[model samples]
Target chain A: MTDRLPHPLRSDALDNRERILDAARALFATEGLNVPMREIARHAGVGPATLYRRFPTKQMLATEAFADEMRACHVLVEEGLAEPDPWRGFCLVIEKTCELHARSRGFTEAFMSTFPEAMDFAAERAYALRSIAELANRAKDAGHLRPDFVLDDLILMLMANRGIHTISKTARVAASRRFAALVIQAFRASPQHSPLPPVARLSPAAPGKVM
Target chain B: MTDRLPHPLRSDALDNRERILDAARALFATEGLNVPMREIARHAGVGPATLYRRFPTKQMLATEAFADEMRACHVLVEEGLAEPDPWRGFCLVIEKTCELHARSRGFTEAFMSTFPEAMDFAAERAYALRSIAELANRAKDAGHLRPDFVLDDLILMLMANRGIHTISKTARVAASRRFAALVIQAFRASPQHSPLPPVARLSPAAPGKVM
Candidate 1:
């Protein structure tokens, strides 16, 4: 009976935290990281005081909001490293990472931007890159990836993948899949001449026909 | 003497117009299409009244500023069509066009955005696409381009190209060149396994090392 007295209040606090994070992720994914804390609070149906009490700064909120995605990124790299075939592993990482970024503009911005103050985030990013570089070296040694493939090529491909804009999430993913396939083909050491994934309707001017 | 009386006024008007366009183009290229008319007037050393009298609206200013680029775009297509090898012509168009867009963000936004009121702009874009479609057809018929290539693939490539962000114009163009080479390889019907262009420094996190 004595412990039960505090249970409701603790659960309420947990609920508020979840709501705040949900709102933050949705807003950030859609509108980007520029969304104000007050707007986020409003969306989450919490007071500014409660929001600030929980997250003191925008960066803190962003880091917390993207924590899940950051973990997923790490997991992706780990999965790629686990694959026995280095080329297939490298391709898997690129395709999955591109799809992940394509689905969330805010995550892309956060990952790509240099956050000087966020040392942990920076470390995680470096670790991911180092792992990928190791994977790439293995692929190159196996004579699967092109000899000239550079780490910068992955960055270049990611930046290009980020440019994909579609009317719907499905369209974006579809477009990303095709783009990744093309990039993989480009990165191949030997020409397999595989048929590309079907084109996504990305033409801005005309809707009926692409040209 | 009566006819010559208005010569100074006409020349002054023409000079103001040129200054306005020069300012617009510079700002739009560097800062994008969101720079205000007042800021543009200030940059041009012209009064707001004069700027408005010259350009009427932001769209007019943009259209006028980008006229030379538009003409250059047309000339690039024409030059591509003049090439003896249809495959070479197609590659040339893609490479040059990607470079063009890489150099100017404003031009890309203007080109991609559907300005419902800008009928002439739409018509010009249509003409460009149709011409490229004709070029693609010739390339495919020559068995140079992959059979599965569709016109939307070009749009997809352009959109992907637009994702390129670099610290300098040179780096951006370099990155675009590498990207174009990769795309061209991906689009080839036969795997040439050609060497890729040199990598550009595009890593946002570590400047000294890519990975």
Candidate 2:
């Protein structure tokens, strides 16, 4: 009964809990989801026993630690839903969601890998997808989004976005932003309004007319 | 001197060599590049020493085995170059190249990973990219391809296409075809011509103005 207390703790226990979470958040953000728990405890200045006593499982800790980010996701989706223009709303959801994923490697991996025990997180993801679907339909009806866009295309974009390899985290985010813009442009039921840069190839060939 | 013979062997040795290559091709095609050389030797009904004698390194084996496919690639690029219409040629190169990659997981990985000692393979890739780049410039000059399309976009597509997870290779190929078409359309200079399928979202949402 005591093991599953929502918040049964003295002052020091509560402090220890906060330190552990802080360490976890820092490590997970910088190093990704695979950071060892013992290392996290060491960083937190807490013993392994103390860390284990507070958070029974890694999944539990991930769920709790990422709760804020999840809430941020919910907020972003809601904001998208609230937009008056459905197409803009759809784009907002995509751009923001991708940016969110790009910023945190751990969260990105977690979201895709499916923490089976994290029912709430799963449910939240499902709900978010449903909302985005509705937004897509609205955008299509508004004639802003192409009629033929499939939901999997978004997943396709995300999976592709995940593959963007750059030198630094900032470079990744910058590249992601550009990728998101390109995706948005691709999705728009419109013509090319702006000129692109010079074409480069992955294979050997005669150099094209480079202007 | 024997090691440097390069096909100076007798009839049975040549037969054994062919069998070894056949085995390597089958295994590499189905199981990716990670399959053990011993397994390949066993499959070929040859002693491991025989296998080692023929091809001292995995890179050499891979380089020789994939030479045909690489030749096909060069032929495809040449065919595109032969076309009077540069834009059509560029699109053909992309579509065909993507299909080729999608069909063979091993080739896809090998091409991207760049095995050390496979200098010839790397040179071919560089040559192909150069040809594609020339095609791109001609296409843009022809007013068919967008001016801003970069060579890296092809890399982006390949990287993204690699992420398409599906139950069957056939399905993955199909999805890849659709994805290629989308990318091609996105790269085209003109406005959206054809209607798309319904938008698919990764997250859940209410049915917004579904038509």
**The candidate that achieves the highest DockQ relative to the unseen native structure:** 1
Which segments of candidate 2 are over 4 A away from where they belong?
A1-68, A114-121, A165-167, A190-211, B1-61, B114-120, B165-167, B191-211
**What is the C-alpha local distance difference test score of candidate 1?**
0.75
Residue A32, model 1: Cα distance from true site in angstroms: 2.2
DockQ computed for model 2 against the true two-chain complex using alpha carbons: 0.11
Clashes of each: 0, 34
Model 1: how far residue A106 lies from native, Å: 0.9
Q: Which residue runs of candidate 1 sit more than 4 Å off their true CA positions? A: A1-13, A47-50, A116-120, A191-211, B1-9, B116-119, B191-211
Top candidate on TM-score is 1
